[model samples]
Target: MYKLLFAGLASFVLAGCSDQSWRTTDIGDIMPPLDFTLTNEEGETVHGEDYRGKATLVYFGYTFCPDVCPITLSRLGDTIRDLDDETRDNIQVLFISVDPSRDTPEVLKRYTDAFGPEFIGLSGEQAEIDAVTNRYRIAYEYGEENENGDYLVTHSSAVFAFDREGQAQFLMRDSHPVSDAEADIKRLASQGG
Candidate 1:
């Protein structure tokens, strides 16, 4: 069929890709490494490099994100549960706090633990948080208090998937279902451990 012929031609061209297509790939391309070190709930330092050699599900939001963070985290836990044990071991779930000003390690731990232990919660100082957020192109705005000094932060809701060696691969929007994420993980895991 015409479609099959076109696909074969596309594969042939991809095999000899040139300067024009250097940054694109059908399976997704490698993005810059995120070199950051933050303190986990256990008061231990964790670096981006420590998660190399496995697919990592990364999300940038606060524990206080009423709708987005909790849903996304829950979906991630569910997606992980749906995976086979080996795939689960090869992947890590990270919940990075955008509200470093208020999200302490304990708070993060508590909020994330309610979902699953496999989820790691990280928080740091303002500068450290800014650096990581910028590297991932995540936007967050906080401040302004209510009568009771309660505050709210508005941020982007996205689930970014990274391959081994710390390169970005895909991003799941707030509307993307857990099934979409599961398919992605299964495909990546198929490439071998």
Candidate 2:
């Protein structure tokens, strides 16, 4: 399975991304095949291969995120719904936790469930999460708890859009109404498989 995932990732990077219009400042530096080892809600070991041929939307945030995370996730769902079925099938959404201390696999899964089953939530060792965040050039830092004992994680609010081949194509900045992200996803799908 790992081998197959690795092969798929390579293919995604090599596939036709010639007309990519998204910029590094916008999408990020064109990245090579990105490999990550994370466990799904079931605690089953998963790699990038499990999401083959799918344009993935990845967000790095904690489940406890009170405002931005929920708003962003709702927008993601709206963005997905805006797409037709055929386009949606070729896409996947990943909710990865930047807060490892409390976000176990079960916690991650539950958080994602509120968003939708199609959304996959993952969290692992602090070092592992940090490494991936660094690779994507996302900035994040933990915040202190309030009087109610609820804390916040201030993080980069961008959502990354990867092509079906798993190649980075666009980094949708956290902006209003998600129409921009919706447009980009459609544009990517229209580019052809």
Q: Each model's C-alpha lDDT?
A: 0.76, 0.76
Task: Please tell me which predicted candidate would have the highest TM-score against the true structure.
Answer: 1
The 10-residue segment of model 1 with minimum total lDDT is 18-27
Question: What would the TM-scores of all predictions be?
Answer: 0.81, 0.79
Candidate 1 on 4-103: residue-level lDDT in tens?
A: 9999999889777742221212224544665688888886888889878887778888887778788778887887787788777778778889888678
- For model 1, what is the C-alpha lDDT against the true structure? 0.76
Cα-lDDT of candidate 2: 0.76
The residue ranges of model 2 lying beyond 4 angstroms of the native Cα positions read: 1-20, 23-29, 146-149
Instruction: For candidate 2, give the lDDT of residue 110.
Output: 79
Using alpha carbons, what is the TM-score of model 1? 0.81
